[model samples]
Target: MKAGFSAFERYKMKGRFKWIAAAAAVILCVGLLFACKKDKGKEQEDISESTEAQAQAQASGEEGESEPARAEEEDPNKLEDGMMRSYLSGLPVDEKIGNRRPVAIMLNNLEAAQPMSGISKADVVYEYVVEGGITRLMGLFENYDDLDKIGSVRSCREYFVYTALEFDAIYMHFGQAAYAVDLLAQDYVDNLNGLGEAGDTCFYRTTDRQAPHNVYTSASGIEAGIKKLGYREDHYDGYKGKFKFCDLNEVVTNEGGGSAKHIEPDYKINKPWFDYNEKTGKYDRYQYGAPQIDELTGEQLSYDNIILQYNKWAQLDQKDYLAFDCHSGGIIQYCTKGMFTIGTWRRDVDSAKDGNVDMAPVRYYDMDGNEIEINNGKTFVCVIQDSALEDIVLE
Candidate 1:
């Protein structure tokens, strides 16, 4: 009976060993399947990473890539060789810029003409002494195509004509000084004379003001005058712009230049001054202890740049009318971005076929002889006589 029990125990042990071996085989098979699944997932992740890298290379125009680069296309706001910039505002111009010439309108700046219309739209404004210790303004406009009215238009001076020609603008004036008459008669000089027989169509009188102050011109009248006079509409070939303007991202405050946080151009009558505003980044203008406002927009007229050009001048006649040394070099002050710079300006004079003097390009240079770079915005030029330059104040 003891021998039989020992054999039975040995049989039970064998059966248990067989069961443990089968369980171990099943565990090994499950581990192999998990390893295979992990390897397949890693292979798919590698392919996705490789595809993403190829796409990034194609976007950035990397070498050895067959796809076209996305970043190399031309910008719509940029023109061919920087032609998209407005000559007056120095800002981007999507319209036909050099395709059409600017219009320089002679505007009266007397106390009676305060709050004048259309000056706010001017891209550049010039204030200079005329007669009786007063100043006149020449507004150079690139986008005056849609304005309803421009000015209580005034007469043209010879120096002002030269200034207008520097921009190749259509000179618009109600009358002219004797000094300007010859220059205006030259074939190269395309002007709209408001005193001409065509004055009836180009200018009108408003009962609100007196005789001279009542005279006004509109955009339609100026356009009609240009067509009637048969003047060239587009800029002349080979016409480079007058200024070397900096990009919008650039701040060209001339280093070592004097500070111009406050500026005063001493015209005896208006007593005009400019104050730099930090918020607007513009120099707000003041005259006669009041803010100078534009009648059209009813907003204070302001400018981004101010230039004080000191030139030699003398009385052209007994009438106290003046003449400026427009062709010669002179002292210049370029004020922009709350800073002022000292420079010089000169223009080349070309002789017309009829032997009359025609204006060439006007250039400004720093003390180092490099062309002065202006900020991209509107400008106001004060043509101060050398004798009166001492009266200019800069703070």
Candidate 2:
């Protein structure tokens, strides 16, 4: 009876040990599965963080690369209000000139007026044939407020009126030709004619020179004339600018471009040539075998830009008077610093305006149909007869 009881106790202890082993196996399997899931979750989290960091780095790099390029594309000389660039020279100024008018003074380039007064102060100077074979000059001045005198004023030509109107300028002349008189009388054209009723107030005679060559005007006189005429002080609503300009910081050497070290445009009257000075990066002006000096500055006249424009011309009536087709498109050569390129120029005529021809603006373009860019400084415009283009010499 004691042996059988001991056998039963042993059997019960073995059964208990079997159940304990099964429970330990189940716990080990659950721990292995949980470790795998935790490891996969950590791996996924690491991948997501790496992708986010890469995306942020790429975005930052792109912005950093584009900023400088964008700045270079836009005009570097752009400024805020109260400061503006001169339309003729591309230089900065304090006044907003869009509203103000330029003064276009007709100057005699005859032997008597060889060393003209106040010419160096002009922002732009236009030379073209008048009556006979002689050439006359029309000076466009923007900053002549303090100039004591402007010219030995000359008579106006019909073509010169068109040039003055391009800038919406206040035209000043000692007299007018028969063709120009009718055009100047138009309400759209604002002029200060020395021979007209306003002559006494707008011009004065200097004893330093003779009759017609002695007539001169000053900035104060011009201001008084503007007040008397009641002309608009600001630009017209739809008025646009004339030329495209290089940035102030940019230096246009025109490398690999055609050279323009010396340029001569034949006017037949005053044989003029411009010699480029490498040191000054400017062209010293010469006319009639001598350096043309302005009596006001006592320095030889110089220019940063020179435009030789070829236009269609005809002899008006039987007289020596000539007429230029100012509205027509024609060839032009642009010279800046010491380089040049061929281009074209046309007047932007708005047919909608009808008889108001003064509203049109002169536009310039390169051979590629893009606007020709000019250097920052004063400009000299020579209107050569189209048939006489062969007379121009350049090296």
Candidate 3:
């Protein structure tokens, strides 16, 4: 019976060993499958990482190549379609018009010269007090090809010639003040005087007005005079423009500025004022209690920017012909977008390499000493006596 029990135990042990062997074989097969999957997954992950690295490298190379081109496209100074910005208005214009020098025509602002012809085409207008508390207008026209009549043209003041020099403009006048004769005779001063040899070629007298107020100029006459005089029609090779302008789509709100809904320069004569028009986003001009309109278009004169530049001034002689210190620094009131900024203006005459004061631009700066950026449109600049600061009003 002991021998029989031993045999059964041996058989049971053998069966148990067979079952354990089968279990071992199953475990080894499962381990092998898991190892194969892990290796396959690692290989796939390595490929993915390599591809990602290559893609990143390609992207970086592309970004490096396109960055400058993209920046150039975004540049505000860059224009499209062979166009250039107007130095006078800061608006886009033809390359030819933008490159040419502007014509600065003197306009009579007296009551008799009401509804001045072709004055609306002026990109920039300057008003300065002359003798007898009266102000004269100097209109700087950049694109005047279509203008048939400009100004009831008036006499030039020495100060006006200096102002025209700031823009490198070709000065045009029917006559000049006696004090201006010597200055106008200077070789650097290229002016078309109606009383000089170019008078018949550059200007004509209208039948409707008296002698002094009757002189007028046209685009054809101006072109004729320019050709006859052989004046340089193009701007200087490296001429830097005055008045930095905002981009085409940009709008300067004059941040931290004062209200400028109504501006009154408080001139004793003419009594010129500006009222902000919300609809047109411009300041409509009024003088002598009436809208200042252009005779050619019959449209009321308006401006996008108005500058009241207060300068130290003196009477030259008994005639009251004034001399404004254009080189010296002065207080400035710059108004735009129904807002006004108190600033300062200075022309660095001493810094001019050529010793030409007219070539120096009168730069405007804010209280913080940052150059003020004006809007892109027609501008009206009023040269007021510094003592008359109290007389000026802005609301």
Candidate 4:
């Protein structure tokens, strides 16, 4: 009877051990779950902080906003003729990332009553290192998605002025707008006479009257030109309709056949909402803040493959350049000698609410903070132009 009791006691001890094991497993799982939650929260906070920093930078028109606003917003500091300011009075020239502000100092030391053909006009001259070779024109506002900055006709005209200075062609980086074209007509003539250099003369903006392919020197012609440069419309752009050739993957991984040298590494990563992971060395493509799916594979699209497709449809050249407006592809394929980053503007405030403000319907402010009234709701000028060559065409 004693031996039987001992065996029974041993069995009960075994049951206790099993219960303890189960309890430990439960506790481990809960700890792991909480750890994961903490990590996720940290990542989210980092992203939020980064976003807020960019917002402050844009509104203040300075980097970091680490410093307070200048006591005098309107300082008399001017740039020399042909030289430009990076920000109106905010950042130094060439240091700014995107075209944060449309206004810039035209003259090195002189001020302008209004833009000469939409180019910054001042008597004192400022000089920048000439960049080279453009080949296409695009209208994209993806970079400006944060502030919803899609440019209008005036902004596009500003693109033309800078583009003319950068590329070899006379009609590459342009958009559709007659009003801007008229403004360019005036500005181009004025600058050529004064400085002997009309940087954006080759580009222009046209209105609906120039539709079906009038602007950008005829869209149909531009399409044909792209094909000549070896753009396969079907294979490129991932079979998406529209002959935009911004595939950076196809450009860098083309088995090295054509003018692929111009396209740099991971250049497409500059597009907004596109993420490049250095840890796993993978690219993430998103649409509307969600992973976009490949129609055929039923899987999330990879940035590598998508960029490869864009490169296939791209246009490449040394002397030519591209200009874009407010669309996605419009900005990525920056195959130009120089880039003209433009922001669009409409009356942010209602005229009724503005108390008859003296500002124009669409005012053109210079880098100096002086306002130039644009009565017809439009302004034009060269924001950035490259001097890759000496052969410039006059209109």
TM-score against truth, every candidate: 0.77, 0.80, 0.81, 0.18
Listed per candidate, the RMSD to the true structure in angstroms reads 33.8, 34.1, 33.4, 29.0
lDDT of 2: 0.75
Error of 2 at 214 (Å): 0.3
Q: Write the per-residue lDDT of candidate 2 for residues 64-157, one digit (tens) a residue.
A: 4443332355666988789888777888876655347788899989977878999998989999987778899999888888898889899988
Candidate 2: worst 10 consecutive residues by lDDT?
A: 32-41
Q: What is the Cα-based lDDT of residue 244 in candidate 4?
A: 21
Error of 1 at 238 (Å): 1.6
Evaluated at residue 57, the lDDT of candidate 4 is 80
Candidate 4's error at 20, in angstroms? Answer: 66
Tens digit per residue, CA lDDT, model 1, 69-159: 4588454346556357787777877547545899898999998987798999888898879877889999988787778877889998877
Model 3, residue 257: C-alpha shift (Å): 1.0
Better TM-score candidate (1, 3):
3
* TM-score leaderboard ranking: 3, 2, 1, 4
Candidate 2 TM-score to native: 0.80
Q: Is candidate 1 or candidate 2 better by lDDT?
A: 2
Per-model C-alpha lDDT, please?
0.73, 0.75, 0.80, 0.23
Q: What is the lDDT of residue 110 in candidate 3?
A: 93
